[model samples]
Every structure is written in structure tokens, then in C-alpha cells.
Target: MKRFVGLISGGKDSFYTIELLKQKEYNLVALVYIKSTDIDSYMYQTVGHEMIPFYRQVLDVPIYIIETNRKAINTDKEYVHTLNDEVEVIYDHLYELQKKAVFECVSVGAIKSYYQYNRIKSVCDRLNLSVLTPLFNLDQRVIYDAIIECMDVVIVKVACTNLGKEIVGKNLNVISGMRVDNWCGEGGEYETAVLDAPFFKKKLRIKNYEVLHHPEEEDKERTVFFMKINEIEVLEK
Candidate 1:
């Protein structure tokens, strides 16, 4: 089996991508994640990242949480296809992993963002590591159906006008699976937290959490809400 490092977020798409690779017999030796202190990352998800520790506990794998926060850079709205200062940090983490053990690939969960996908690929290209994006440009409905069938997930953030606070902390099915307008919460419309996945040893039961909307002072055309994970308990299937 080929050993590869998977870049994971506590989100539906990333978890699904990891499991899909596992099903194909990829040896996922370690999980890589970025602790983005800044919220506006052009390539990574920043919302509801607090649950990463819980995900680590369930997967029982060595996780390297690299600090990839670059506040001064990436202020431009114009998206670039090349790796900027932020991706260099990610490349450093993967390089360390390669030194520890030989790995051929780094998996990502890009779905429609060409900027994100290309940036990750370009960064991996520098390290001679292959970039695997299993969810690239797939139909959101198909991705949604596949994710719900295997992973137990909840919405932790909603950034679009179509989503509301009521949808947060509920199952992904809370948003109708057939709804094409905002399915899979792709393109920053919303974000998900994976409580349970097939690779997980136990399922996550949300014991307590609070849904908080973005402050009114920073309000935009649409309201955004995030679920603050107060507590989670693991259980057997």
C-alpha cells in the first residue's frame, strides 16, 4: 500500500475524500491540518476547526497541526493560482513528513475552487509530492448523497442567505439533499463538522454546543453563523 498524507479539516468533504482513498487501499500514515488563526483563508477552511482534536482522538492517528496563519498577506481579492506565503508553510509540514517517512501523495478535498485546487497542486509540485483531489468538480448532489450515506456530520457554519442558524448543529440532511442552490455547503456558502466517519473508531455525540451568529457590526449581505463546540462524547457503533 502507498503511504500518503491527507490534508484534513473536520468537514464533510475532507472526511469523505479520506475514506474514499482508504477504500482504494491507501495507507494514510498521518493527517495534516493548518491552524489558521485568520478566518479569511483563500485555500483552507477556518470555521469550526475546534473539533479537530476530537477527530484525531477518533481516528487514532498522528496529526501534525501546522500553524499556517499569515495575516499580512492574502489581502487581495484577486485569487492567484500559485503558492503564496501561506502554502509554503503547508509545504514545510509535508516536507517534514517526507523526511520522517516516504510518502507519495498529499490528498485534498477541493470541489470547485480552481484557485484552491491549483494552489495546493502547485505547492505539492514543489516538493515532488503528488496532489490527490478526489472531490474535484463533482456534482454537489452526488457528493452530498455519498457523504450523508457514510459520514455523520453537522453544520457548524452558515455564510449564505439561504442558510440559517436553525441548520447549524443539525444533521447535513437538514438542508434538503436535492436542493442544488446550496448543497454540500461548497464555495463558502456553509461549512460542516464531521462527527462520525467510517474510518472513525467511534461516533461523536454532541453533548453541548452553542450557535453564534457573526457580530452585527461585521454583518454582510448575508448572515453567517458558527456552532461553538462546547462538548462532544464518543460512542461505539
Candidate 2:
């Protein structure tokens, strides 16, 4: 089995990709989280990363934490530079992980973001690390339903005016009744965290949280609301 380090964002696609890798008998050595302090990070998931600790507990894999330094950019050159910066931290941690044993590849949840796929492939090429995107090119509805059947996820952030603030902090199932503009949730429409999944020994029980409204962005036609995680409990299966 090939050894790998998965990039986790506490989101459905990332977790679902990891689950698929696990089924394929990959040696998941560690999880890498490229934490972004910016709520509006372009290269990575910014919200719901606070649940990473819970994710580690569920997966029983060591986590390598890295901070993202790139600011959001629009130009192709600046965007490429920023992506390289993001990959640098992940690559640095992969190097550290390799001291314990040889790691063959890095895993991600890239589906349709050509920009993300290209940037990741570019860095992995330089690092001699194989880039695995299990969810690549899969149908959006398939991806959405696959996640629903595999885990218990929660909406931690709703970035679209189409989705109300009430949707945040609710389970992924809550989307069932809504008219989803994007079932994939890949376009920054919303952000989620896997509270429980098939591989998890226990599920996360979210007790309390504070909803923060990002009205400025809403006025600007962007992410409207986010949740601040305050309390969590682990429920044994």
C-alpha cells in the first residue's frame, strides 16, 4: 500500500476522499491542515478548521498543522505565487513526515477546480510527490449524496445569500429540503465539517456555538455567515 498524507479541511469532500483512500488500503500516515487565518482564503478552506482537533481524534492519525501565508489575489502570476506558498508549508510537513517512513503521495479533494488541481500538481511535481484526488471529475450530485451516506456533517458556514443563517450549525441532511443552487458546495457557497463518518470510532456532538454574520461580505455579494465553535462532545458509538 502506498503511504500518504491527506490534506483535511474538516469538509465533506476532503473526508470523503480520505474514506475512499482508506477503502483502497492506502497507508494514511498523517493529516495535514493548511490553516488559514483569513476567513476569505482563496486557496484553502478557511472556516470550520477549528474542528480539526475533533477530526484527529476520530481518525487516530497524527496531524501536522501549518499556517497559510498567502493573501487573496486576482492576477494569474500572483495567484500562482500564492499557491506555491500554500504548497510550501504542506511540502515542508511532508518532508518531516517522511523521516519516520517513506511517503509516496499526498491526497486532496479536488473535484472541479482546475486552478486548484493545476497548482497542487505543479507543487507535487517539484516535490516528487504523487498528487491523489479521488473525487476528481466526479458528478456534483453524486459527490453530494456520497457524502451524505458516508458521514454526519454540519454546516459551519454559509457564504451565499441563497442560504439563510439558520442553515449554519445544522447537519448536512438539512440540505435535503432546500433548493440547492450547487449541490457540490465547491464554489464557496457553504462550508462544512464531518462530525461523524463511517470510519470514525465516535461522532462529534456539537453542543453550543455562536453565529457570526459577515454582513460586509453579504453586502459585497460573498460569504454571509460563519459559526464560532464553542463546545463539543464526543459520542461513543
Candidate 3:
């Protein structure tokens, strides 16, 4: 079995990728997370990131949380190694982790975003680590259904006009009836957080939270809904 490091964004896709990796018989050695300071990062998920550390307790793996200023210096389809780009920061962190841990592959959950997949692939290439994207080209609807069926996920953010703050903090099933282009939020229509999953030793419980609405500056008609979780707790299953 190949030892691999999984990337988690506190979202369903990334965490679910770990489940797929397990199914493939990969030895998950560690977890890496990029905590973006900017919520609107072009390359990473930023919502519900505050609760990421709790995943260590649920999965029983060492997690490395790296902070990025969220500066997407390189936006081209093909990535080039650069010092100032956020991707370089990821490469640097992984490079440091390699010295302490032995992992040959980096697992990602990029379903449709080539920009994300490409950048991560570029970094892994430089580190001599293979990239494992289990959900790279799978059907979004099927993935969405599987996640809803096997995981306890909540809508933590919404940016589309069709969605509102009412959906925040609610289970993912709430949006199943609604019409949306990307069922798995591939196009950034919304964001989710996984509270419980089949492989988790413990589940997360949101103890308290408040809804926040931020209207888009470019388009005043559109508002982004966010669930600001003030408190969260981990419970035995």
C-alpha cells in the first residue's frame, strides 16, 4: 500500500476523497490543509475552515494546517513554479512535511476545476509526489447524492442568487430539490461542511452559529450567505 497525504478543506469533497482513498487501499499517512486568509480564494475553499482542526480528532491522523495569504498570483491554465504564488507556498509546506513524514502521493478532491487540479498537480510534480484525484472527472450529481447519503453535510455558504441565508447551517438535503447548475458546488454556487461520515470515529456538532449576508460589490443584486459558526463540538458516534 502506498502512503499518501490527503488534502482537506473542511468540505465534503475533500474529506470524501479520503473515503475513496481508503476504498482503494491506500495508506493515509497524514492530512494537509490550506487555511486561506482570503475567503474568495480562487484556488482553495475558505468557508467553514475554522473547524478543520477538529478533523484530526475524527480521523486520528496528523494534520498540517498551512496558512496562505490567498494570493492567486498565477491564474493561467498551466502552472509554472514561482516564489510569490500561493501554489509555491503549498509546495514549500509539502516539502517541509516530506522531511518529517514519508508519503509518496497527495490526494485531492477536485471534481471539475482544472485550475485547482493543475496547480496541485504542478506542486506535487515538483515534490516528486504523485497526485490522486479520485473525484476528478466523476458526475457531479452522483457524487452529490453519495455524499448526502453517507455523510452528514451542512450548507455553510451560498453565493448564487437562487440561494439565500435560510439554507446556511441546514443539511445538504435541503438543496436537493432546488435547481442548480452544480450539485456538488463545482461552480461555487455554494459551500458545505461534513459533520459525520462512514469512516469518521466521531461526529461534529455545531453548538452555535449566526447567519451573515455579504452583498456582492460588482453585482448588488447578488448576496453571499455564510454561517459563522461560533461554537462546535466533537461527539462519539
Q: State the lDDT of candidate 3 residue by residue for 1-237, as single tens digits.
A: 999998888899988998988988999988888988877888777888878888878987898889878588878898888778878878988899999999999998999999999999999988999999989999999999999989999999998888887899999999989998999999888998999988889999999998877644445654788888899999999
Among the numbered candidates, top lDDT falls to: 3
Local distance difference test, per candidate? 0.78, 0.79, 0.88
Order by lDDT, highest first: 3, 2, 1
Clashing pairs in 3: none
Q: Estimate each model's TM-score.
A: 0.90, 0.90, 0.96
Tens digits of per-residue lDDT for model 1, 48-95: 777777766788778887776664354344434335467667777777
Indicate whether candidate 1 or candidate 3 has the larger lDDT. Answer: 3
Candidate 1 residue-wise lDDT at 88:
66
Clashing pairs in 2: 159-223
State candidate 1's TM-score: 0.90
Model 2: lDDT to the true structure: 0.79
lDDT of 3 at 53: 84
Regions of model 1 farther than 4 Å from truth: 72-84, 177-179, 216-222
Show pairs that collide, candidate 1: none
